[model samples]
Target: MSTIVRVAARGDGVAEDGRHAPFAAPGDTLTEAGEIIPGPHHQPPPCRHFPQCGGCQLQHLDDESYAAFVADRIATALAAQSIDAPLRPTALSPPRTRRRATLHAERGLVGFTAEGSHAIVDMRECHVLHPALFALVAPLRALLQRLRPKGRAELHLTLADQGVDLLIRGRLPDGLAAAEALTGFAQAHALARIAVDDGYGPETRWEPQPVAVTFAGTPVPLPPAAFLQATAEGEAALVAAVREAAEGAATIADLFAGLGTFALALPGRVYAGEGARDALLALKAAAALARRPVVTEHRDLFRRPLTTAELDRFDAIVLDPPRAGAREQVAQLAASKVARLAYVSCNPSSFARDTATLCEGGWRLDWVQPVGQFRWSTHVELAAALSR
Candidate 1:
């Protein structure tokens, strides 16, 4: 018998001999016949779509085992670079807390894609979405049934300060009957806003007023399909880490700052550089209206990152980059005079690579806070602090 000692990066169980087993838990034992014997850490998945759903990869593990998995993801990433730091306990969000999600729709089917397949799950129940977002699913199914030529589309759902803001892509509420049906659907459900896109761009078909997201005690207008942290708990964890890292700094440069997630909350003079026009304008307007000292700039970091010479002027820096990570930007930061830095990332592999670059430049890894925002999934996020 081979005992499963750990989980691989993609959620498969690994034995001491490097043999891999799917759906096996950390303590599970594999028999010579290649069968998984249930272990103490293995729990019956709550979701009916568990093994088939691409949305999650670790639902079979118990709570303690799941938490360990999240923590190990960060620890392993750091160890890969031969770096060590005082890592705080990982924060895990509860199920049904997801504030934003993307669901697929085709013909009469609606839900997430199947694992490793394009076939739709047609969700009858979802344990990951906020109740409000899930509440729209049935009605959305009805609306799609009424207003379509039986074509494929996508549903982008986000719970805003006002209510659920929905965007449908690849199709629209076409024709007068379809348009009327859509208006009735939006009004009946009392949705905050609804829009459609036929590949060109999203066009607002209905809006009660404005949609916004409240972060760090401020209400920032929510742009269509704007980036948002998956869960409220996850956002709080990231923000607390960033605030602790940036405390006492008089001036801070927030790079890749999407809609001023940190700039709106941070103290002192803050400059935010974003690549999205709508998000940049929204952040600027919100800052001015609230009389906050946050300046916004529109620049593509991938094309031209903030130069080291320019980055040296700030007392501290904050980086919240996409999953691809900020290799170029981190390279520039490695040569700058900034004393403190906070990096929030959703990809552990990418984060490790960039942290190595910063560590090679004499910066020390102060601490890291792992967050399980997408609960029961292999995806991991973290907020880390570095100092000279």
Candidate 2:
């Protein structure tokens, strides 16, 4: 028997001899016949859709083991780049805290897609989504049945300040009755907004009032399909880490500042740069309305990164890039004279690559804060502080 020593990045348990066991946790024993013996870290999955629903991967792991897995993911990535830093305790978002989720509906079934397949899992119960969000699943299934959509439809649910914001993408039965059904559903659920995208673009079917998402005490207008942190606790943790990293800086530049998440939270003048026009405009409007000292710029850093001269103006910098990471921007930042930076990323491998580039430019990685917002999943997020 080979004992599983650790979990790999993709959630497979690794044995000493480099063997892997699927859906196995650390300390699990694998028999010669490939049967898995559960260990202390292993527990019965809460959801019946375990190992089938693509929504979660590590439900079999206890919280302690899950935290270790999250931290190890970051450590492994950093080690790959030959970089080392103090890794703080992992901040884990509790179950049922996810405020945003995407589910699919087809043939009267509504839920996440099946693991490694396009088939829907027909979610009867979910453990990861917020109660408010999950409550709509059954209703949505019913509504879709009424509409009787011939093709599959995608449902995007986000918790806005007022209530749930739902966007449906697929063809639906078109008529006054169809319109009335959608409006009635929204009103019954008290949805903040409901939009549908048949093919061209989204059209609002029901919006009692303008929908917005609050960030750092400021309400920014919510754009259709806008990006948001999975959990509020996770966002708070990242913001706190950035604030700590850029402390005492009077001028800060927030690159890839989507909806001014980090920019509005930081103390002092903030220069917010984003590539998406709607996101940038929303942030700009929110900043102006709140009388915050945030200057908005529509710049694509991937194409035209801020030059070293332009970057030198900021006392500190904060960047929360997409999964690909800010390769082009990091190149410029590495050569800049900025004293401090807080780098936030969802992809550890990309983050480590960028960290190596910055380190080669004489910057020292101070510390890293690992955050597990997508609970029970392989995805990980982090914030790192670097200084010259």
**Which candidate comes out best when scored by TM-score?**
2
Worst 10 residues of 1 by lDDT: 142-151
lDDT of 1: 0.89
Over 1-388, each residue of candidate 1 has an lDDT whose tens digit, in order, gives 9998888778998877679999888999988888999899999999898889888888888878888888888889889989888888889999999999999998888899988899998888888899999999999988787776346898999999989999888666558887777778889998888988888888888898989998777789998789999999899899999999999999999998888889988999999998989998988888998999998899999889999998999999999989999999999999998999999999988999999999999899999998998988899999999999
- Number of the predicted model whose lDDT against the real structure is largest: 2
Provide the clashing-pair count of each candidate structure: 0, 0
lDDT of each: 0.89, 0.95
Residue pairs with backbone atoms closer than 3 Å in model 1 (clashes):
none
Query: Alpha carbon lDDT of residue 52, candidate 1?
Result: 90
Model 2 segments beyond 4 Å from truth? none
Q: What is the TM-score of each candidate against the true structure?
A: 0.98, 0.99
